[model samples]
Target: MLEQGRLGTRQLTTLTFMMVVGDMMLIYPSVITSYAKQDSWICAFIGVPLGMALMAMILKLCSMHPEKNLVQMARSILGFWPGTFFSCFYLFFFIIGASTHTREVGDFMTTQIFQYTPIRIIILMFVIVIGWGVWHGLETMGRSSELLMPVVIVFIVVLAVCLLPQVDTSNLKPVSDTGVVSISQGILVSIIYPIGEVVPIMMILPYAAKQAHQTRDMLIAAGLGSLILATLVTISLLVLGAFLTQHNIYASFVLSQKISIGSFFERIEAIMASSWMISTYFKAMIYLYAFIVGCAELFKLKQYRMLVLPASILVFGLANLVSPSITFIVITVVPYWVDWDTTLGIILPGCLLLIQWLKSYRKSSVTPNNSQQ
Candidate 1:
């Protein structure tokens, strides 16, 4: 079992918010606007409830098996071989997810700030820091998030305020110009990439110090995170407009570049980048921690910290191999990646819940028969 009393509800909430927002904060505006046009904010709104439902499902599973994390629960409920298979699958999912986050951090730094720096160097530097956080365990990661999240929030608010003068409310007009089909597509993408990514919280939920109302806390965190994403999307639409948002890969970064206050507070994209880097680091750390813990559980190892280095090495290699280019990443995200996540996030967990329920029902029926006999 995970070390108890290591995390409180507040830390878990902050971690969830950071994980859900993750790299999506930088790129989602552009991706959603490409599909939903000026109504990308609407996609965020639509995705909120769906995101909550997904979170609730994962929380229910965690609540059912409070003493065990997802990997352990799978093993106990699904028997040895089958459980090991699913656990390994989840491990792979987290590794791939973490690698993508790693690549995203490198891509942003290389393209936006350090034009001459090699991407591999950026990836190495980031992985080392992330690996350090994971090696110390979840408490360190949680505390780091608690300290950094406020700064991130402040930077985001400042960026929004600075860009207010540039906002064109008319840019958000003709809201449904893309029609229902396109807007629906955007909503699905929004939920899948950012909101639905909260599935990994299942692994962390068992570690919370206060577990009495964890489900409620998780939903609130996820809802608040979605709301924040919606606010950023709205800001992006108003300031950058739909056309520019769709064309720019890092729309929020581009939005930050537009921030200026009497020319003295100009070029504040560095601040924006820093906030994004913080969010991405926490995001990657959560995924990396999950991957490490899951592997330890799968192999029945007592210490997960030992796996951190090898895992980081594997993730670094995969980050470069899996994402050859941003276009390829985008192409895969919509069709293949989202669907795969849905299977692990919803379908597999749902199946496990059903099996667990059946087992309980059978046990109850059997007990009644034995008493009668």
Candidate 2:
């Protein structure tokens, strides 16, 4: 392992917590509402347990491999070529995830927040900062997550409380009318978007100081983060209603607009933007870190830092070219992106777990037969 820093348990939990809350903060409610309408909060209620169960499976796979990160374990367990292909699959997933997320921030910033700035410039600057952070390495990002988590928590509480006056409880009244099918679809989407996204943490799990409580720590963090997200969804549905929540790409951003205490606390949507910005920062940094680590491990490089600058350049270029426009992503890309996230997040790790179990079973069976012979 080129990276030797150990993350404290708090740092590990913070990273897992951020995984569930990060970029999903702005878009999760909208996607869920689009699928389940008035029952979006119900979908959230259902998805948390499923997501935690998925986390447990990922943890089991990691434990089976001891200290090996995902890339190393893939090669070791699946054999050289198969593991190499698997490793490449994850590498692509990481860079593409980082690129797409950077594009999102660029689009939001240029169209909504900084209309005067060019998208390319905004993306370039964001990539530079993320690269700088990744260059400093895992420990710094771990600490940064712990620092940013409270900001996210406060932003959620503030948005929910301040928007209470505008919240129309009736907006959620037509619930369950969306039915099991739609709610199930919404749960699937929400599970993968932010909740299942914790699969990337496998890349850095070994960097954390191993604790017997690692599983508990992650589950608690994931549960807490999902609770925060579900609260955001409920608030959005109550305040913005299903139609507006579904139509608005930044539903939480729009929800923050309705926060009016004494009618004077208006236009402070900066709270939403800043909270989201903090989350997006973590998402991009972790994905980029994984991409760099995966590449070095794949090629047997001496150090991962050598790839950081060049990878940032590639990420910036890809961010600009990710889609024809933000509308394309909103309408055409997202439906497919959810499935892709699940493939990387759940299916891949699940396969790793299965393959390792098969190998262990074979070894035990063979030993028993050889002893009898």
Task: Report, for every candidate in turn, its global Cα lDDT versus the true structure.
Answer: 0.84, 0.88
Question: Candidate 2 on 12-122: residue-level lDDT in tens?
Answer: 999888878878899889888999999999888788888888878888898887788888999889999999998898889899989999999999998888999989999
Candidate 1 lDDT tens digits, 1-373 = 6443388887888899898888888888887787889999899888888888877877777777887888889988899889888888888888988998999888888888898999999999999999999888788788889899988888878877888888889999996888989988888877777766776777887787865676687688888778778888999999878898888889888888887787788888888888899999999888888898888888878778789899999989988988777777767764587678668876898899999989989999999999999
RMSD of every candidate to native, in Å, equals 1.9, 1.2
Clash count in backbone of candidate 1 = 0
Clashing pairs in 2: none
Off by over 4 Å in 1: 2-5, 333-335
lDDT of 2: 0.88
Q: What shift in Å separates residue 64 of candidate 1 from its native position after superposition?
A: 0.4
Residue pairs with backbone atoms closer than 3 Å in model 1 (clashes) = none
